[model samples]
Target: MKPWSFLHISDLQPGSPRSYRFNQAMGENADTAYKQLGEVEDVDLLLVGGDLTRDGAIHDFECEEARDRLGSLPYPFYAIPGNMDTCNKHTSVAGATGRDDPRLNVTAEQLDHFALFFGEFPWSFVHKEVRFSGFYGAVAGSGLPHEERMWRWLEDELPPAGETKHHVMVMHYSLFIDSVYEPTWGLQDKEEYGRWYFSIDQPHRSRMFDAFKRSGVDIVLSGHIHCRKPPETVDGVRFYRCAGIAMPQAANLWPDGDTRLGFYRFDVTEEGISETFIPLEKESTAEGKYGPGGHPHPEDRDYSLAWEEPPEEFRT
Candidate 1:
């Protein structure tokens, strides 16, 4: 009957100066987003789509700070771990990128460590006649014990849990890149590597879609790719590839892809849910950092280039 609003923000990896790499623009952009979030009114809750920190997988301080920073928001938030917070998706074969992909696969301990700060994920609850569900989709193909639990939860637990006026699913990675049924992208193919890195693979994507349908999910919000594309509806579900809070990536990769930096605001009412893009007041131009961009090998990291002293463990 009455209307309410909620927010979806992701990839605000406000990097720490204490790390080998520190991007000042990202930090400033994240700060701007935080201030803007504080000003928004009548929002029920925030669905943090993930990548809450720059290097949460390795640095406990970053995880702790991300928790505290988000906790300062005007309302409560339900969050899931992004790849940066844990580790990249599982891959036995290295990609076109020089990084050792398999060695960087998300570990069970990494997942648990993330939970230590953000709480257990694959979580669902009903708020204001709307069902909100969040999960780390990367775990689907991880082959870890958590993968079994994720499957069990998606297949068995959620379908019969209950019903609601609407269901919104929050995930870090987009379920698909271009189309829901697109062929799986390959890691070895340089042209297809970005798509492969950004989306869930074949059987898993279809399986998740089926589970979402069975569970009455009408809307799905995801971030990982950072470039927001026009919403794509497959079957009966509307999939929104949300904007990033940090910086834009792959903006020109898609014809309709929007390169703006910001987040999404959704209003729910008796009619249904309507969404809007809230672009950041200003994109950060501040720049300064150490180390390299993209995933860098640990051995290749150079703490000596850091402006501030890095943590003892990070310094070689």
Candidate 2:
């Protein structure tokens, strides 16, 4: 076999100026990434790690637009849903953010909406002796039909996909914050919001880890944290906490966390997979009026502030 390359990027949630919420800088950053990604050559595939839109949960147009743009890539791209694209991870109790966490919980309809646009997820396929698999780990324990599918796929379907030279698993949320044994983050604790927001909770985390081991997964890629952390090799598997292309976050949370805005290029060959970080050619310095960040309530959204007229449907 010959060495092949692929690109992995995520969290390009650069919402449009036509929406009630728009950040010029974030949008430009994503544009930069989009342009830069197109310039790369000879890539076998593009693995989109999710959060492809800012408000895809509420707006179908965002998903359609994203599909068109991503479709323009030179190579085939595989995708999964991020919180912004579908909905935030399931939360039984309200979080410390004061936002209605339960209300923000992921819904079946939203997952259907995402699938309608981006195709069904919890998918697995083999290319060039490597197996690429993606799933929405956030759906675990949600009791939604998608959650059941996720478990069945991970447990039954993926593990038996036959042996491959390498198995690369893509997930939206980090399986754990620092260690696999780390306790589930508490949403009610103000200090744990970042941890809670970024990771999978409880027994689901352990189950997924076990399944990965059984499936002989060589590498795991995750986004949603925005910041990239140093890769951790547990047992024999290498887990990559990927960087976000749209913006950076959780800079101060982890001592080794890198808030650099970039994507990853992996070269797989007989020796091993070599990872390289490709920073955006230009970081957008553009700025504009923006509403309060961090999941504002619908009532608080002000469409009148948009630089462009908000679509009639989005207007409140």
Candidate 3:
């Protein structure tokens, strides 16, 4: 099959009016990055990982606005939900509701809103010789019925009982990496409202990874960690964790502190897949907006967020 190029972006996180300043900064950064991608000559598809909003409140229109902005891109775009995405309620379709009203907490309006904008959950499509399937918020132990359905779909699609060139999976949370530590970081934190967020417990993690292993998926793309690193292979599957578009987070995993805001480009072919990290030139340096005492409040002594060099493993 002919080789094709696609843009992968994640963690837009549009804050609400109460946090308009944050949203504005993030939106500006995202717009600039999207424009840069458009300038590239030969891109086919756009894949947005998740965290489209700061909070999933219907009042927080930033996520919808951001989606419209991204839809203006030259190529077709696909997306999935992150933990922050589920913050708002989703209304059920007349016949689409699950048993036990799995989406009982979701409002019909919210569900309709998401469906109208993003389409049904656990959506799938095929392009070229590749099969692209997405699992919205399929972290280990989300316990959400939709998440479980997505997992089942993944198991079914993995080893497509027929001939296919490649299988690619997209989701908001990283399945292989340890994004959630013992403490509340990443998306695993338990919110005060009794809502269990994105962390995947041991059994679920094992089952999910085992399914991936059994299915022989070629790659998994995720975006919750917000690190500026290239794809890494785990259990024979390549996992590409796209960087945040706005407000690069301090490297929680590494003490040396490697943090920068950027996205990735995947060049896929029958031969193999090549991925590159495209650092945002406007925000590349540690000066100005990202300088010390910037909005994200990087540790004063740690100039690492802007200057720290990436580890050898991140070099690709």
lDDT of 2 by residue, 71-132 (tens): 99888899999999988889888989787888888999999999998999989988988899
- For each candidate in the order shown, give its overall lDDT on alpha carbons: 0.89, 0.89, 0.58
The lDDT ranking, best first, is 2, 1, 3
Model 2's C-alpha root-mean-square deviation from the true structure amounts to 1.3
Candidate of highest lDDT: 2
Writing each residue's lDDT as its tens digit, candidate 3 over 142-215 gives: 34565557577767755652345676778776654444223322222222111122234445656666766675
lDDT per residue as tens, model 1, 1-316? 7898999999999888888888989989999999999998689899999899988988998998889988988899899999999888888899997767888788999999999999998899899889999999898788899899898888998855248868999999899988888988999898888998899988899999999999999999999888998887888789999889778898667999998999999999899998999999999988676678777787777777777777788776
Q: What is the lDDT of residue 289 in candidate 1?
A: 62
Considering summed lDDT, which 10 consecutive residues are worst modelled in model 1?
157-166
What is the overall TM-score of model 3 with all chains considered together? 0.70
Model 2 has an lDDT value of 0.89
Give candidate 1 misplaced runs (Cα > 4 Å).
Answer: 311-316
Error of 3 at 16 (Å): 5.0
Question: Considering lDDT, which of the candidate structures 1 and 3 is the better prediction for this target?
Answer: 1
Better candidate by lDDT, 1 or 2: 2
